[model samples]
Target: MKAIHLKTLTTIAAAMVLSASFPSYAAEDMSKMDMKTPMPDASAVTEGMVKKIDKDAGKITIKHGPISNLQMPGMTMVFHAADPAMLDQVKEGDKVKFHVEKMNGALTITNIEATTK
Candidate 1:
């Protein structure tokens, strides 16, 4: 039927337009997304031991002390690093002091340093 054909054409056109516009839409969506939890203060850095490090993924697993700013009690959890290059300074079993924040809806390490003392 002509009505069915017209509906199919409309759906296909809409899909094409959406696909073509998706990248911009996604970028805008990211900017508009709300973080449910407040970010931890940068000044309230925490000390932790690196349990794992995935350089390729820019993530690290740490067993940390209490993060008072975020109201997070110490536990081991994985976090994305703000700068992948900082991953180079750390390895598993190393002690580190790091800055954490709620970045793009997840807890992220914004600053990090490896330490022995």
Candidate 2:
């Protein structure tokens, strides 16, 4: 009967140790929690108004919505054009839908289209 009591104690001790270890891991995870907004997906697109166009610099400034791919908030920022010919297709005050991505370590508009509304 003493051996049975010892076995029960050993089982309880092992379970206690295993469960105790998990709480520490959980607590550690809690301590390193992320308290920021969810990140945007990589293939997201944004709508923007063309603010400026600089063909000579191969850049265009747009007041755009959140660029999910870049995690950037809506603001006026200059983005390098992937193709300079794109400049001819857009002008200031135009509403456009554009896809932005990191290219050569710069924010670049990979594809853009002028919206009719």
On lDDT, the candidate that comes out on top is: 1
Give residue 6's lDDT in candidate 1 (0 to 100). 81
RMSD to true structure for each model, in Å: 9.3, 16.0
The Cα error of candidate 1 at residue 44, in Å, is 0.3
Model 2 lDDT tens row, 7-39: 899999999999988755477777798743232
lDDT of 1 at 110: 80
Candidate 1 Cα misplacement greater than 4 A, ranges: 1-43
Positional deviation of 15 in candidate 1, in angstroms? Answer: 34
**Candidate 1 at 26: error in angstroms?**
28
TM-score of 2: 0.61
Off by over 4 Å in 2: 1-43
Candidate 2 lDDT (Cα, whole model)?
0.83
lDDT of each: 0.85, 0.83
Q: What are the TM-scores, per candidate, against the unseen true structure?
A: 0.62, 0.61
